[model samples]
Every structure is written in C-alpha cells, then in structure tokens.
Target: MSKLFRAVIMGPPGSGKGTISERIAQSFGLKHLSSGDFVRENIAAKTEAGVQAKTYIKKGLLVPDLVMTRLLLPRLEEMTKYSWLLDGFPRTLAQAEALNSACDLDVAINLNIPLETLKERLRHRWIHPPSGRVYNMCFNPPRIQGIDDITGEPLIQQEDDRPEALVARLRHYKDVAKPVIDFYKAKGILYTFSDTETDQIWPNISTLLSTKIPTIQSDARCASTH
Candidate 1:
C-alpha cells in the first residue's frame, strides 16, 4: 500500500495558512481539510453534532472537547485512504492528544508570524461572506474599496480580526498552542517557518515537505498567480 502523509498546520489568524495549504494541496495530491469548514458544513447540514455545537454557541459558550472530537474524527476516518492536510483542528493540548490517539501525524507545520505583521494584515483583511473569499488591502486589494472582486458585493472585516478582538485571540492562541508545539517538537516532526509574508515562507515549507514526502519535487514553486 502507498504511504499516507498526515499533516497538521498551526498558526495564528492572518498567518497565511490557508494560502499555503491551498498551494500544498494543489502541488501535491493531499486532501485539504479545514476545521472551520468542517464546523460550517455540519452546522449548515444541521447534523446532531452541529445542533449540539449550535446550542453551546447560542449560549455564548465554547463547544466541549467531546463534541469537537466527535464532530471531527468521523471526517478523518472517511479520508483514511488518502494523505491529508489539516488546518485548525488541534487548537488545544487536549485536542492534540486526542488527534495523536486517533492517527499518526507525519509532520506538524508551525507558522511563527510577527504579531505586528499579523495585526496589520488582519486589520486590512476583508471577506466576501457568501463565498469566503478573502482580500487584503496591502497584498491583494479588490477592484473597488470594500467590495468583493468576483461578486462585487460589499466586503466586511471579520469581528475577530478587528483590533479589539485580535489582541485577545492572539493571546489565547499563544497560550493554548505552546503545549501543542512542544508535543510535536518532542515527536521530531515539527517544522517551523517564521516570516512576514506567505511568499517568503512558502519556499521553506515546500522544501521541507518535498524532502519529507517523495511525492513532490524539490524545485517546485507555489506561483504568485495562484
């Protein structure tokens, strides 16, 4: 049987994990799964897990570990036949341990972006809600200010990306993610990239994965046009 490469990406908001993940998925053949997407899907489908999560969300409470694990694990099981890249799943130490027990991870990529850079990037970030298309003022601005490029709908910044909420989110992410990073480090498969732009970090990440997995070529580049 062919080997399966399971990878998890860890980064704070506005760290370009999504862009890098898409490049990796396109360059290689790994299935890409985003935890946020999973929750959104379940909630839209009104599944049991979604209903339970919605109850907690409506009450202004975080979803329990049990519910998160129950909701995410089945999705992984369905992808047992393919190598996959996961984003935003194991946010806490408990989630990391749970994931460890479920499957072996080949590598865990940590993006160590500067706080100021993250703040600047996210502050300028706006999205098209219906399609989840993100546009950054500094990097890729839309044709019109505060407008979606594709649909021409008004774009709005996410509440969490706003200055007031960004500080708290970054603090919480650092606190919860340290142990998870340490865990992967101990396992000897932790590869970290520190940069201000996704383009700067993509080459190193591409090189690392290419070295670790024989499915890709070392000379491959994630094009800016993507």
Candidate 2:
C-alpha cells in the first residue's frame, strides 16, 4: 500500500493558519479538509447531520462535539487512500483524542503569533459580503475606504471582528485550545512556528512538510523522469 500522510493544524485567529494550510496541502499533495466547509456543505445538503447542526446554528449555539465527530470521521476514513491535512476542528482535547482513535496523525503544526498582532490584524478587517472578499486597513486596504475594490460595494465588519468580541473569542479559544496543544505535544508530533507574517510561515511549513511527506520532497525526482 502507498503511504498516507495525515496532519492537523492549530492557531489562534489571524495567525495565517488557513493560508499556510492551503500552501502545505498543495505542495504535499494532501487533501485539505476544513470543518467549516464540511458544516456548510452538510447544511446545504440538508442531510440528517445537517439538520442537527442547523438547529444549533440557527440558535447561535455551537454544534455538539459528537455531531461534528460523526461528520468528520467518515470523511477522514474515506481519505485514508490519500494524504490529508485537517484544519479547524478538534478544538478541545476530547476531540483530538477522538480523532486519534479514528486515524493516527503524523504531524500537527501550530502557528504561534503574539496576541497583540492578532488583535491588530483582526481589528482592521472588513469584508465585502456579496463576494466574501476580505480587506484589511493595515495591509491590503480597498481602493476607496469603506468600499470594495472590485464592485465598489460598501464593506461591513463582522461581529466577531469587532474589538470587544474579538478579544472574548480569543480568550475562549485560548482556554479551549491549550489542552488540545498539550495532547499533541505529548504525542511528540506537534511542530510550532512563531511567525507574525504569512510569508514567514509558508517557508517553514513547506520545509516541514518536505521533511515529513516524501512525495513533496520527491517532486523534483519525479519531474526529472519526464
């Protein structure tokens, strides 16, 4: 049987975990599995799981862990034939352990960014709702302030992106995320990169995956034969 690579990623908001995950998945030939996308897809399909999740979502409550686990496990089981990377699930130790029982993870990368930096980046964020385009005042600002660059539509700030709500969310994430990190650390598969910029994080993630996933490291070898 061919080798299968499985991994997970964890980071606080605005730490560029999503960006890094995409790059790593592309480079490593790994399936990029996202819990948010899974939830959205299930809700759209209106499956049994979707119905259960929608009730909590409509009420602004978190979907129960067992429901999330049921949704995620089957997907992961199906992907055992290919390398895969998980993003934005297993927010707590119980979830991590449950996933481990399903499939052993090869590595887990944690992007470490200072809380101040996260707060600053999140504070300046604005979104064009129609297109789901995000702009930041600090870095990539719209051509005209308060308007999107493409459609000239007004941008709205997400409720979670507001200063007070962002702080509270960060605190909650910290409280829940620590034990998950600790659980992975105890397994000796967790690698951490302290990076403030996505550019910095990408190189490290690429290098790490090249070391862990042979297909990524052997791309040049395979290319040479053609």
Candidate 3:
C-alpha cells in the first residue's frame, strides 16, 4: 500500500485556505476534511461530542479543546485507508497539542498573506444571506453589483468582514496561530506560502505536493492484481 499522507492547512480569514485546500484535495486525490463541516455534521446528528459541543455553542462559548479533539480525532482515525487534508481545526496551541497526541502530521501548510492584502480581499466580499452564496467584488462579482445572481436580492457585507472588525480578527488569528506554527515548524513539517494572490501561491504548493505525495495509482493497481 502507498504511504498515507496527512496534512493540515492554516490561514487567517481571506488568506485563501479554502480555495487552496480545494485545489490540493482535487489535485492529490486526498479527502478534504473540514473541521467546521465535521462539527456541523456531528451537531446535526447529535452525537455525544456534538451534544456537548451544542451546549457551549448555544451559550456562544468556544467549545473546549477536549470536546474538539474528541469530535475530530475519531473521524480522522476512520480515514486510515486514505490520504487526507484537514482544514479549520486547531485554532489554538492547546488544540494543536491535542492533535499532536492523536496523530503525526506530515505537513502543515500555512498561508501568510499580508494584512493589507487580506483587508482588501475581505473588504470587497459580500454574501447572499438566504442562500449563503458569497461573491467577491474584486473577482467573482455577481451579475449585477450588490445583487444576488440567482435571486436578485440585495447582498450584505457581514459585520465581521468590515475593515475594523477584520483587523481585530486577523490580529487575533496571528496571536492564536503563532504557537501552532512554531510547533509545526519545530517538527519540520510546516510549509508557509506568502503571496498577494492565491493564483500566485498555488503553483508552488502543487510542486511541493508532487514531490511529497507517493504514487497511489500504481499501488492500487498492484493491490488489485493481488
């Protein structure tokens, strides 16, 4: 069997982690496991950890590290047969440590976009609330400015996406992420990509993964023959 690859992508909001993660998953045939989506799925299913998580969430409290690890680690254990890319978990040093105890990570991809760049990107972002469709005025603008393409409803900029709020959020992310980055760096698995645009950074990530990921197709063929 080909060696299983495990990776996590980290970035502040507007740093293009989602787009980059999507590309990595598609290009490498790794399952993309989003922590946010997983939490939501568990909550919808009302699993034990999910039920615990809901109480904190209902109180507008961040779920404790223990609950997060309990919710995440089991799902990861189930994917032993497949390479995977994880996103949006381990927002703090404590969570990172919990994850470290659970499994060894092969890579920690960090996006270090400039504050100004992030601000510009986020400032232009708008969303259609009803359908949860997002549009970037700079790139993927709707057919009509300030209007949802499908419903023609007016789009709204999230309060958190505003410049002042974004600055505070981004600062908080940097403060929270530094220790995690250092932890991965010390482990020699952290790869940081810095650029103003996702397009510019993607080629470098693709090259890195090409060298890192083993050829799974041949392994699959060999298994089939046996």
Candidate 4:
C-alpha cells in the first residue's frame, strides 16, 4: 500500500480555500474532509459532542477548543486507511496543538492573497442560501443579474461579506492563524502560495504535490514489496 498522506489547507475567507481544496482532492485522489460539514453532520445526528457544540453555536459563542478537538480527532482516526485533505479546523493555537498531539501532518498549505483582491472578490459575491450555491459577479455571475441560475430566486449578500465586516474578520483571522502557521513552518511542512487569482496559484500547488506525493508513495510501495 502507498503511504498515507495528510494535509491541511488554511486561508481567510475569500482566499479560495474551498475551490483549491476541492481541486487538490480531485487531482491527488485524497478524500476531502471539511470540518464544517462534519460538524453539521454530527449535529444533525445529535452526537454528544455535536449536541454540546450546538449549544455554544446557538448562543452565538465559539465552540470550546476541547469540544472541537473531541469532534474532530475521531474523524481523523477513521481516515487512517487513506490519504486525506482537511479543511477549516484548528482556527486557534490551542486547537492546532491538540491536532499536533493527535497526528503528524505532512503539509500545511496557506493562501496569502492580497487584501484588496479578497475585498474585491467578496464584494461581488452572492449566494443562494437554501442550496448553498455561490455566485461571484465579476467572474462566475448568474445568468440574470442578482438571480439564482436554476431557481431564479433572488440572491443575497451575506453581511459578513461586506467590506466593513470583512476587514475586521480578516484581521482576526491573521491574529488567530499566525501561531498555527508558525507551528507548521517550524516543522518545515508549511507551503504558502500568494496570488491574486486561484488559477495562478493552482499550478504551483499541483507541481509541489506532484513531486512530494509520488516520491513518498513510491518509497512506501518499494518497502512494502520487500
């Protein structure tokens, strides 16, 4: 069997982490595990940790780090047999430490988009909340302006996406993410890609993974055969 590869992608909102993560999962044949989706699933299923998390979420409070670790670590344990890419967990230094204690990470991909570019992209963004479909006016606009393509429903911009709110959010993200980035950097597994567009960054990430994945997998395969 090939060696299992584990990675995490980190970026502020509007940095295209979702799109990049999806592409990485598709290109590398790694399972994409989204922390947000997993939390929602557990909440829907009424798991103990999820029930505890939902209480904090309902009170407009961030879930405690212990709850988050409890919710996330077991999910990682289950993915032991396959390579996987984790997205949207470990938003703080405490959580990062919890994750460090749980498993060794092979890579930590960081997106370093310019502030102006992130603002521009987010300002033109709209969403169909019911279906969770996102549309960007500058690039991937709907067929009719301000309308959902399939449902023709009027789209709404999230208040959090507004420039005023975005600045504060980005500031918070930078503060929270710095320690985690430093932690990974110290481990020599952090790769940061800076660009105005996701397309420009994709090729570089693809090249890095192509080199890293095959070499490790081949070595593991050779050892297994012996």
After superposing candidate 3 on the true structure, give the runs of residues whose Cα lies further than 4 Å from its correct spot: 46-48, 51-62, 126-135, 141-157, 215-226
TM-scores, one per candidate: 0.87, 0.81, 0.80, 0.87
lDDT of 1 by residue, 1-226 (tens): 3467899999998898777888899987788898777876788899999988888866534577788899999999999988999988798889999999999998999999999999999999998866667789988899999989888889998767887778888888899899999999999989999989898999899888887777422222333224
In model 4, the worst 10-residue window by lDDT is 56-65
lDDT of 2 by residue, 136-195 (tens): 887779999999999988999876777677777788889989999999999999999996
lDDT tens per residue, model 3, 1-226: 5667889999998888767888899998999888877777788889999899989867645688889999999998899888889988888899999888878888899999999998998899898765556688986899999999999899998777788888888878889899999999999999999999989999999998887775544565578788
Ten-residue region with minimum lDDT total, candidate 2: 215-224
Instruction: Give all candidates' CA lDDT scores.
Output: 0.86, 0.81, 0.86, 0.88
- Residue-level lDDT for 13 in candidate 3: 81
lDDT for position 87 in model 1: 89
lDDT of 3: 0.86
Q: CA RMSD for every model?
A: 6.2, 4.6, 3.9, 2.6
Top model number, lDDT: 4
Better of 2 and 4 by lDDT: 4
